[model samples]
Target: MKKNKAHSALLNRYQKLINISCDLASELDLNILLSKIVRAACEVSDAEEASILMYDPNKKTLYFQAATNLDSQLKRGLVVPLDGSIAGWIVNHQKPIIVDNPQKDKRHFDYIGKITSIECKSLLGIPLMSKGNVIGVLEVINKRGGGFNKEDQDVLLALGAQATVAIENSRLFLQSDLIGEFVHQIRTPLSALNAAAHLLKSNRVHEDQKKKMIDILEAEIEALAEMSSSFLDLARLESGRKQYNVKEFDIRDLLIVCHEIIINEAHKLNLLFILDLPDTLPLIRGDRKQLKQAFINLLNNAVKYNKIGGEIILKAIAEKDRIIITISDTGLGIPEDERSKIFEKFYRVKSHRDHVPGTGLGLSVVKQIIHGHGGEIDFTSEVDVGTTFTITLPNEI
Candidate 1:
């Protein structure tokens, strides 16, 4: 009877693995695909939590891309160096390891434990390889009933193999999709450049008209340059290759810095800039530089979309476990129908497209950064009444 029960459990696990393999093959969204892979890892391995650490060849480092145990996205971009890290060793040697007590393993990265606030008692890590290339590591932590065994290793290795292929396919699909959209977006600016050049070369125009044509050329050139830079930024972020330098910093100070930098520009438009922040606030963890970029993008938008002499209000408050920020502007608000697409790539408000000079990529970049930090961003707008954007970042207060 005992042998029969053991055989049935083994068969069930393999069956579960087969179903997961089919599920992974159909997913094309990189983020969703990764989440599914990790969750599946936990279910099949009978572990408490699972994580996927992807290797960035350009940086020669590994970063936490997805995890089942993390409470927030604070650990997503946390870097694990190749030296003195188990994940790094797996990537370097391209093999599997079963460490029953990570505390005794000198190769363990204890900093990660502190960052995620999760203790690692047992760990089973496998290298995710594809086409002779070491791509990343798949790890399941703290097996439930007992230490990791050969069966657990066998199952995780099988999952990792399928996961690596799925990841590569998803990345390729994203790149192709983004490239097509980018090509479509640049055609308008290119045509404007061509038209300006043609008008400048003709002898039939007055000197004043020629100056106007030169101005047009300069503006279009500037727009194209900005578009190129923003495109690269979006691509890197979407590909998950962007490295974040994580540190603990006060949100209040970051807000002040942003206000100081943009206040002059707001003044040029005869706008009022107000910063309402508490004297004392909790310090948050994450990539400070990326968070700053996210804030600056929203602030710039508040200014850009506002009417002359409009008011921009920046307020912050700390709750028990999170910080809330709202940037309100008394300007042209987004339309009801278009609000859903605001964060989509290359999407611009139909009303503002003609009068406003923009690439429509700023908000997309902003959304990516905000979400990557394990935060949420939302906004409320009324036509001509104004718009207010709310951001919430996780904190330990």
Candidate 2:
């Protein structure tokens, strides 16, 4: 009777794994897929916590990619040395390891435990292998009931195999999608440059016309440069490879600095800039530099799109558990039909496209940065009235 019951449990566990494998295969978003992988790892192994450390072959380094019971942002892309880490050992040997007490193990990297404040009493780590190469390590910490056993190792290893394939597929999808869009977007600027150069060399071009052609060449060149830089930023963000330097910072100070940076340009356009902020606001824990970039993007947009004698408002308020920020501009608001697509990459507002000089990639970068910090971004607009972008970030990580 005992033997039959054990067999039934084993079958059920395998059945669950099969379902999870299907789910992982269908997920394309790298962040969502990593979360699903770690969650499934914990469920399959009956462990208290699980994490994934991705291996970067080019850098020859391993870094934390996801975790079940920790703020992943705090540790994402945090490097684990190959010489003194269990995850590193698993990757090096391309084998699994079961440690009953990680504290007693000299090879354990305690820095991670101290940094995350998550005690690692026990661990079972397996190498994630694809195409005969170790791509990463998947580890489950503090197995339930007792120390990890061979069955736990076997199940996690099985899951790791499926996870490896899923990760590679997701990465390939990101590369191909970004590359296709980039190739298509670059052609327009390149064609303009070619046309301007050809016209400048023609004898029919008068002196004034030649100067105009030179101006077009310069503008087109600048657009291509901006487009390339923004394209790379979006690519890094979308691929889950961008390392965020997380820290606690005063939101008010950051906003003030952003306001100062763009106030001159706002004034140059005859726009009244208002900073409506509380004297004191909550300190937000995130990557300060990335957050600064997000704020600057919004502020620049407000100034860029505003009409003469209009007003730009930068406002912030703190809620019980979150910070609310809004950047409003009395400019050409987006049309109702195009509002839904504003955050999409390389999408420019149709009516303003011809007159405005922009790469249409700023909002996409801002959205990615905000989402990466465990925040939300939304907007409300009315044609010829105004537009407002609201960003909500957590009070703590």
Q: Please report, in order, the local distance difference test score of every candidate based on alpha carbons.
A: 0.90, 0.89
Candidate 2 Cα outliers beyond 4 Å, as residue runs: 1-19, 57-64, 70-95, 103-119, 130-134
Give the candidate number with the greatest TM-score. Answer: 1
- Total clashing residue pairs per candidate? 0, 0
lDDT string, candidate 2, 1-397, tens digits: 9999999999999999999999999999888899999999999999999999988777778888899877765467667888899998988888999999998999999976886788999999999998889888999999888899999888898999999889999999999999999999999889888877877777779998888888888888988998999889899888877767667789899999999999999989999999999999988878888889999989989988889999999999999999999999999999999988989998999998988889899999999888877789999998889999999998865
Summing lDDT over every window of 10 consecutive residues in candidate 2, give the lowest-scoring window. 70-79
Q: What would the TM-scores of all predictions be?
A: 0.94, 0.88
Lowest lDDT block of 10, candidate 1: 69-78
State in Å the error of residue 177, model 2.
1.2
lDDT tens per residue, model 1, 264-298: 98999999999999999899887888888889989
Model 2 TM-score relative to the real fold = 0.88
- Evaluated at residue 250, the lDDT of candidate 1 is 84
